[model samples]
Target: MNALARPFSVAAEARLSSADLPKPETLIRIEDLTKVYDPKEGPVLDGISLAIGKGDIHGIIGRSGAGKSTLVRCLNGLVAPTSGRVLVSGREISSLSGAPLRAARRDISMIFQHFSLLSSRTAAGNVALPLEVAGVEKNEIRRRIPELLELVGLSAKVDAYPSELSGGQKQRIGIARALALNPQVLLSDEATSALDPETTEQILALLKDINRRLGLTIVLITHEMDVVRQIASHVTVLEHGKLVESGPTFDVLAFPKSQVARSFLSSIVAHDLPRQVSERLRPSPAPGSSPVLRIVFAGQAAHEPVLAALVEQFRIRPNILHGRIDYIDDKPLGVLTLVAAGGTPTLPGVLAYLSSLGLHGEIVGHVL
Candidate 1:
């Protein structure tokens, strides 16, 4: 199996537990953050409050016009909030001005959706621009450029100009430039949206590796659910500039509470039944109909032979209509939609049994 699929094949005991994570440190805190460009248009960010722990790959996801871009800009001090505070490393970013704000931004670096490299500058020169702007000596710039290039696995492309590199290579250069100052927080604003699927995975893997090596706290801003599923330890959902849901990625994915969140996760997880299946479903059980159950298996329950147990213990045959199994942060999460024949009379006992196994079982509908 490939490296990505390997995680799904591993035993549940090998899964990383929440206790294995580092102790919480409030690295970035946003309290009641609101940003309004025009009085009549309403706030772009509406009373947002959140805390990002140190050494976390946190994803903030929303659709277009969801204020995702505005929020990231606020985090980096590019746009001042109308009401509320943005604190990074215990400094109030919204309160700072001019030189202090400029200096404060050194600790918070950002990579853009577009690889914002100068057309004339080579990879090494682009990486050196930040150091130069900070007034570092030429000798220091010379020494730092190669190290940054090497960190992003682009040391050999030091002399290649932006025009000469592919999209992925240009992104590597962009990542190198973002890390030039060794910032405390890295804001990725749709950094992988421009790349192909294969290249996106490569970039995400690289980012996860960087997070592991440097203990860097990353705020990933994007609309892609797969991006959050692949790398983010924690996820926050935004809709119409409001904070809808936020929590550990596995928990959110396995048991989403909001409509928007469920919609976003539907692509990766079977949050809703297929349209054709739904059309066939009835609200109440008919004479020859079977009850369709939606079962959610998370953590240890994912590896258990629950389906076999249902057949053996309850003497019910399960016909799977739709199902998907996915790993989030190396832990298995699965959702199965199946019809339980001859299980209507024993439904209560089956639900209790499933609950005993720490699984969620719900009767969605009945279908003949």
Candidate 2:
């Protein structure tokens, strides 16, 4: 079944209200940003407006060709926007050029998906290239290269060439090179998409450390949901080059308001019904059937005895179909699919029970 087919009224998982909008510690702000590749083809990025708070690991995700790359490139003035303003550290850079643009770009660093390292240069040599380009003193470059390489856990690989290094090590060299400029903002364009699962986790851990130790503002664009779920504090979704959804990663995952966002959450926040169960599923329960329900738990309710409470209060024992809990920003969020026999009459009350505890329970389909 399509995961986005059902909508749940979840006030607990709602986005931040406008009334409570205080002065946020914003480091990067894009206002009505639009990027058109071909005027005949329309805008690839359409009226995008979002904020990346200071020290935030902000993630932008979407399917391929959703304009994710264009959006991030615009942040650093790599792609000129067709219209709108981009402000980094409160300085508008959409129109700046020449030496001023170069000066501004030094504060914004980028780590590419493919480790953009020189095959001829060793890890330390690659890291020193940025400083050399900026014409820093040779003494300082020598002092800083080892420090930057050590920061990325590449102290031992300082003399290793890109061709000799593993994918993860090469990316680490790229990261070290990006950090050599000491930029406050770091942009990662699918940095982990090229790594294995275990290596991806390691790189993510290293990024989290960098964000913590250096208090860096990171903005990453990826097509992988796990990348955002693993590290991003805030997330934005793009659909056909339009801003479809944007919010805290947990809030967006827990309560997806758009079809594209809901589809993205299917594998992570929600599980699909098994084939046999789905084949038998009907809008109404059969004589000897059970009602299938999707129970969503987020925030504090994720730790509560939701299923046990339902059994006690409503006298309905749920036959678990599938369930999983995941941590986002160190908070527990979970979803469970279950079949409850002879419980349709009391479902409204059960849903109320779930809501009272900051959960949402929806009657999905009926099965025999």
Candidate 1 runs further than 4 Å off: 1-23
lDDT of 2 by residue, 1-368 (tens): 25343122232223332236565588999999999999999889999999989988899999999999999999999999999999999989898988999889889989999988999898889999989988899999999988998898889987888999999999999899999998989999999999999999999989988998999999999998889999898899998889999988888888788989877877676655656666777997778777898998876566688778778888887898878887765556788989887687888898888888878788888888
> How well does each candidate superpose onto the true structure, as a TM-score?
0.94, 0.90
Candidate 2 local distance difference test against the native: 0.86
Give the C-alpha miss distance for residue 175 in model 1, angstroms: 0.5
Alpha carbon lDDT of each predicted model: 0.92, 0.86
Task: Return the number of clashes found in candidate 2.
Answer: 0
Q: List the residue pairs that clash in candidate 2.
A: none
Model 1 lowest lDDT segment of ten: 9-18
lDDT leader: 1
lDDT of 1 by residue, 1-368 (tens): 59866645555324443567555898999999999999899988999999999998999999999999999999989999999999999999999999999999988989989988999899999999989988889999999999999999999999999999999999999999989999989999999999999999999999999999999999999999999999999999999999999998889999999999999998998989999899999999999889999999988778789999999999889999999999886678999999999999999999999999999999999999
